[model samples]
Target: MFNYAESIASRNTYMTSIRETMAEAQRSKPAVTISMDGDADGKSHRFYTNRDRLEGDVKIVAPADTRFDEIYITFEGTSRTWMERLGVSPAASGRTSVSQTFLRLVQPVNEASLPIPRVAIKGQEYTFPFTFVIPERLLPGACNHTIAVENQSVEEAHLHLPPSLGDHTISTFEDKDDLAPDMTRISYAIRVRVLRKKDTEDQPVVLADTARKIAVSPSIPDAPPIHIQDRSTEFVLRKEKDLRKGLLGKKIGRVCIFAEQPQPLRLAPNSSCPPSTRVPVSLTFVPANAETPPPELGNMTAKLRTSTFFSTQRTSYTPTVSRSTPDPFVGRYQESTLLSSRCVSNVSWEKQEPPLSSSSSSKPVYKAQIIVPIAEPKCKHLVPTFSTCFVTRSYTLELSLSIRTSKHSQPNLALKLPLQVSQPAKDSREHDSAPQDTSVEEFFVPRIISPSTLQQEVAVMAPPPPPPPPPFDRRQGQLPQSMLLHPPNEMPPPEYSVFRGTGGPPVRIPPPVGISPGCG
Candidate 1:
């Protein structure tokens, strides 16, 4: 085997001569002299040489066995790089073991020592051709997996990962005679490269750097789906499809717009789903095409129920729109000046109660009422004039009803109430009268007529039927003939203001009993 030991002496000749002389004295060997002999034209010089002077030069040499095992662990400069091989020998006990528990190496920064791969002995070194075996477990409890050694002499050249300066931990075994305890264990990161050709004068290019460390444990676990609710309607398992339905042939995709009160949830289907628990929910749904509403759904809404823990639960259902048509009415309210005047004096229409249906359905049904709020007018002249006296002349309101159906089969009723206002009749005392000539005082008689008689007179002067309907095109061009001015004969003859009184001038009668003037 080729010896890989580094040479100790340099190639300087002067030092070699001095060493050879000293070697002779130490070995008690024979010494030689030098002389010079002159020739015919030139002077000659001679130097002494030791031929076969084995003992003289040999004594100065250090014995190959003399502490050849001892190593100073010397570093060459501010930065150091060294490679070492270790071998084990048995100690006095005959059992081989790592005799040292603690080892030391130098590094400027403590963190830089973890990557070195070799170890050196303090007092001994070994030649190449030795294999070092280490115990499987040592300092087993230490948390760090990597060990390193470093040279701290240079401030900037501290040892680091992949430890260029040979930073690594090693174990030393005791020798059999307790003599050669130079063996050590070395830990190192594997360095590799690509080479072109063997034996070529060139360097291999580094491909990659890798650190090797011990390993210990196993791997970590996925997280779980969220549940939401809708307000306004009670529903369960409120999903995006709750209110979506297809039209004639269009497919309606379901969509749920969750409010911001709850955090935005993302369902990573590849990962995991959220938990299904009661949660505070403000969710809403919209038709796939908002501009064109879903025709299948009617009166759709969401009802949400909240819990004390701020969780919400919900259920939803759609109500239908009314489809029933209302009954048509062509009847007219006659503009009767007297009969209308009479009815306004004392009569009123009360609201009728809605009768309960005999069905066994539990759904709530709404009942309605109609009331005629009438303003009656007061009259003082009819007290003694007629058996049934006029109390007040006022306008009143009348309400009419019709029913319609919703698409969800719910009832949608229509209501039309006509509002009417009556103006108060002018007081007879405020009329302006022309000054009468002092010639004659007109004589007048008080004629008495009953209510029955007044009714008879009003029936006789009624107007004729309206003219035949005009063509649609012509009708559009003309105003209704009913609104046009009529002939004097067509005008209903003015009926008597009072059936039993002569119109000589309203008599200045005294106010009625228990009646104060201007009380209205």
Candidate 2:
């Protein structure tokens, strides 16, 4: 008689025992730690793309008998963005996203095989060092891809493509952004993984894996010298009661504003300017009439402002109706102030009286020199200036001057100037000459290791060079000296063959026959 129930119970117990043993072994496995050289003592996760070389070490802590199938580290740059719809019904919702990848570098890590192959034992702790270079040109994202046509039509449809068709091509890196938290995001990260070989039918398993976020920003170049001058039209201090009446209000004197600098202002990419750079500016206020005195200049201020405009078109498909319809392209605009200069407390006025003999009159002139300082943004949501079918960012320099007219009322004058910010041109020498800052080192440090211990580990893990190849044997009948010294002859002309038919063997034709001397 066969007892099937008892047999099944015994088999179940055996399988459970096997699983327990495997789990226990995994728990006792050694830990893996990774760190980069030159990272800040407190912050060791961030890295940059402009770094020339990145060096790091991997440490494995395991029992004396523990073994590893493979050990290596990989460096990569990744960019991802997506959008989701909100609202009860799909018909009422809209979609928006940003795509850009200014920097991307991926280097395949070369693994160092164990001497015994698939067997590694560390009594205490073992470390392996690796180094790689950051490439000057990053891998182009699909977003930067363009199609060439002899002639292309300019139409709304042609300018905008649906996300489904353009998603793959939307590959470009831009400054990090957290705007539209529910709508879009851009980021970069470095990931490390370790694998362990398995003896069972199950595939090789990952023993340990970790990832860290990295910030990538365009480098700011030195600003160039710039000078600009403009004059305002005369207008009344108060608003007119009617368009037909021209003399309803008192007239305020016309004013001229002058600005000059020794160098052109350098704008950083994505409207994010560095806090260390400053723009030197000189302003002169001149009244329209030489007889009129210049208006008293009160508090004066300047600021850098950015405006972002975005547009998108959504299409809906109805299965029952067997038709597709698209909604009109909608646009949204938002403005922000990035940097502001300190207020100018006061301005000195210089008066020039008329000459004793001449009848010409002179007006008072107000002059002031102030340095405009740039500061970092208050939030992390700032993004570089960019323009695409769906999004565009623009910047401006705004200057406001307050005028003291009477004891009770003071009028304010405002001016807006368009500003352009960009990275250095590809051919510019500044890219190569830019000084490297140690604060943005491209290395990661494990949290568990101390500074002294890390230095010792790196020193011990340095690899030694292999021995030189054996010397060549001269007695083994080397090439003759005459042959080695002989000059090479001219190359022979290429031979030509003609095919008679498709998929047929080629037919060789001899050189055209020539008449003999006697026959000629």
Candidate 3:
């Protein structure tokens, strides 16, 4: 039989030995640590693109009697994406197609090395201070360049039918994030490595390496506001069986909708007043035709819809032809209704009679003011509206009106308007004209936490209850509490014969039909 337990135990022991040996070796290797200026506790690892320079120190600690051939530090910025087909498609035979691409935002490697050819050092620590300038034109975030696929054959193979059978494909720019759900990632880091000299080898070996993650954010300018206008004319037809009214002809009425804003609404990744921002809307209804009077208005609704789209170009490689051709950039757009609210459901309409005076020239007009509350950013992972090659985010607003009339029970009117949300500009006209102050002052302030305050807050949140009393014996009632709690121990029961039954002792069987005890 195979002993699985022994095998596992042996494997565990071997792994433990290997880990201990590796740890011991690592302890003797040279290590590197980074420290940045303006970071009091040496924990801030963020950098800005607008900044001119990044100053930091590289600390190196070597074991006793350590010799190194060279020591260097390198900085890099990388953006990578891996995408798979989301849904079922004819092109994806049994499995989904996946494509991976790596973009080097900062192509040229920036490295700094010690000038000394060979350095011999005792057990000591060394610090090397350095500074590097941030590139002004570095890409703000993870970005990709994608073009629409134009191959007819590839499109036909992927589609269920001919291109004419379905809606025409529209090209769009998509903006994605570092933590996008499409398994995309963008990262920036700094690495430090050391080369140590080894005995009996002409080439030096890599002793130790260390890397630290850094955050990079580039400033983007704000966009302009949007304006939209829509107009429609609803004609009132003559009633059936009214021959006299048909000869006179139908009456025409006009409905106009106009919307305008001075500035674009802004949505930031981490905004404090995300929900407070609102868009003001004005709704106007006019009864122009004299023959056809305005119907009774019932309810009105204003809905704001937000959508996020993820798109990418897939390149297919043919094994038989030993070549690869890019497929048409297929984009899957998804829309989500972020917010919907009824502006005015119960509308009261007042009938305005035409004036008898001949000089008066006016019609009945009804107006209402609506303020649509903008949807707040639900998840902290939400990115500002942006357009990129692979991903895009857009928003739309819809207004619906319900009309109730005697003849027609329910009549609905709808209008769709496009909206553009952007970030506030850093240098607007108002900011540029503001006065500046050149006063300079310095002061020291300290904050201290009191133990009692912490205790009070904890008590308010969850008060502690008194500990339960120790277990008690009811048989020893009225005894002293200490004696009852800690009673003296007693001896355990004595053991009995193993062969006897459990009823105090074995029953002596007298001779069951024959000699029993003696014969057994």
Candidate 4:
């Protein structure tokens, strides 16, 4: 009634001016800027891989001369993940998060280390060029997951460098989408900090700071093929469908469509272009009678399934997105991309002659093998399967077939198989691998190990327990032994109390992560 809208607009305008003034003031301070030579624009993308040089320059400028105790640059990689629970009531649900800085490399630019003086001169500029070589593997302490498999350790699955993910940097409709959720992120950055001595002689005080983000996608080696269990949601290796001439027609016979899991998709680490792989499949046709033949095949469609797993709380094992867990902070998400759809033609069905004793038998069989040239992933922004403490990514190949069947009620046959996207394994850092022709039958042949080989692998993975330390007193110097065994910051293992409805001794529970992508 009293021109309330005009007053509100005036207030908003006043606040905007205040924010602009503050931002301008902040920008005028002694500024630090970073430039990564390889990137096109500032902070957009600086891509690097293992054993590559990350060269950059840091510049500091001030209107008046500024003094600093020391300048430090840190190359750090950090991972963070969060989960939100959806309960019947909003009050019951909550959000949980976890984070870790797994890789940290610090270099100090003290007065003695650099040629120029430490202070930033007035009206003049100071530049510091830095070069850091990315490592191939992380330190052993980077991951702390419990290992259950024989001849395996936390380093075995998680030591390799993880690609830069979840930042929406690679924006595309197809392969560019990392399939990662908004809640999970793995980031790498070059952080520079200017420090001045604190009056209390405690930790240093930061005079200024700036960071340049990096997009790192390390070339990881090929992992073993994923072991798949029988699940309707997982894979279908073989199936039979009844054939007919027309809609609601008589059954000519049943055609058995079966395929062996295709081989791993090998990818070049530094190829000139995005690589493509082939999917080999075998189909068997079993007829109801000798008069019946295989049904006409339609288009075979290929789709790539991307699965991402993220957790809010620390998990001692890999996370699975398909199964629901009671823990509120862990979850999984999935996305799919259509690769290609092509007409199924030029299939040669070879006749198998029956054995002499079975020649007179009524059974009839035919076999044909086919290889489908899978189309390249939609975009070049694809990341191979990799897992870190907070986030994990994997892939699956889905093949769907349309068959010309007689029965109107029959449905199309589909198969979901594990697809391991692999890169050339490095023999060493100096010698890059030149891939030669290798067998693509990563699925058809199961690994066989002898006793000696098993023993050797076990010795490598499961080392002997360390010796107990000498007794130490808490009051004298070191921390209490119990505190060393169980740190106060971490969550203890779940406990069973006698105050429960069913009273018994405490039962140990298996870790919550079950059936991750690569594991069975």
Give the better candidate number (3 or 4) by lDDT. Answer: 4
Best-performing candidate as measured by TM-score: 4
TM-score per candidate, chains pooled: 0.12, 0.49, 0.48, 0.71
Model 4: residue 179 alpha-carbon error in angstroms: 2.4
lDDT-wise, the better of 1 and 3 is 3
**Clashing residue pairs, candidate 3?**
149-328, 149-329, 174-391, 174-392, 175-391, 175-392
TM-score of 4: 0.71
Regions of model 3 farther than 4 Å from truth: 1-17, 21-30, 41-49, 63-75, 86-123, 130-134, 139-179, 193-209, 223-262, 266-278, 286-363, 373-382, 389-520
Over 1-520, each residue of candidate 1 has an lDDT whose tens digit, in order, gives 4234423334355679899987764443211111112223221211111110101100012212121111111111111111222336433223222221111222122224211322222323222111111112223222121333122221111111110111222111111111111221222211111112224655532212222211100010111112223331222232333232222334433333222222211211112232111123222323344243322211212211111000011101111111133211111112111111111112222222234563443222222222222221111000000000001111111212111122333211111111211112123233214365434533344446689887777667677677965434423435444422333233333321222333232234555678775564
Candidate 4 local lDDT, 1-520, one digit each (tens)? 5499999999999999999998875755568898877556565433567776677788888766666677788899989888887889989788877888989988556555442555667767778878777888899888765644323543466788888788664322223565678888888888988777878888986767887777777777666555655664566777777776676677777666666766666665345566777877777777767767767667788898888888865555665544444445557788888888887756767777666677575656788766777644655356777777677888878888776664454346787777777555444445334353357656567878899989999998997988876564445546543434433343244542232334344445444476544354
lDDT by residue for model 3 (406-492), tens:
443444566555555554333334322535442421233443649998887778899679786666464766754333433334212
lDDT of 1 at 332: 12
lDDT of 3: 0.46
* Per-residue lDDT of 89 in model 2: 89
Answer with 3 or 4, whichever has the higher TM-score: 4
